[model samples]
Target: MVEFGSPVPEVVEALAAGFVSRELLDWGGVALRLTGVRAVDQPEFGSGRVRWRTATPVVMKGSGRDESGALGPRQAWLLPTEPEWPAYMQGNLRRKAETLGLDPGVELEAVNWIGPKRSFSVGNGLKPGAPVEVELSGPPETLRALWSWGLGQANSGGFGWVSA
Candidate 1:
């Protein structure tokens, strides 16, 4: 993810050129791979909104700050069955879009839990990985951007990587 940040197109081109290299590119100790992507039918809800689903598990982390300007412990997990999950994910995506100077009207539609949630040790503590599919409806361009960039926190760390 960090490798694909600024100057993304060039980085992607370089990676593609070295696609058959014996050495694999690793991000924070985790090896990375490039997968083929395809566009699927955008599910439509009763409200006439089109939505897209994720093909990979999305990892999210929530945290707060203390009065002394100290960072709080990170609580990472997947909230597929929670009612507030959509709002939470939407907020993160919206913030990212805004940061990129794009005003996308994206909204989370449904979350389908695929179970087998597990936790893994990250930088300082544990982070949960829940394999669940989500449906999000929004502008085609915006959705495409999100699909390529990713969703939620720690995206550069390979979290919240989504697909359509």
Candidate 2:
């Protein structure tokens, strides 16, 4: 079972079925906030399911020299495989911004349907759908948002990553 987070289907269906929010009895009494939904599938792994809820998944697809003058992956997203995945999604500020529709205007040049987390950062001409940007070092709000997004989209057959 996904420890720190709950299943995306349960959360989305609960909310869609007239439950705006629900408390995860398993996770030390933490609450989840959901926004929207999407459909996803992974045919290669023979693991096709519908991902229901969604987080405004964000990815950056450009490369430029920052003030630090360092080179890094041009395209990036809040991936599920990252060690910081849970913390990034479960922050307070991120949730607040998500609820407020504060999309940061960044876009992912490339995206993968069902592949390794690193595979999510490939391609070009991608765009974000009302995504919000929260700092990696944000507050509790940021983690909260990531949590909501992750669990809400985790096993969603109709959300997040899809396989075509």
RMSD of each: 6.6, 15.8
1-34 per-residue lDDT for model 2 (tens digits): 1212222446555544553343233333755444
Q: Tell me model 1's lDDT, rounded to 2 decimals.
A: 0.57
Number of colliding residue pairs in model 2? 32
Give Cα-based local distance difference scores for all models.
0.57, 0.33
Candidate 2 stretches greater than 4 Å from native: 1-15, 18-59, 63-135, 150-164
TM values, all candidates: 0.61, 0.23
Q: Deviation in angstroms for 43 in model 2? A: 32
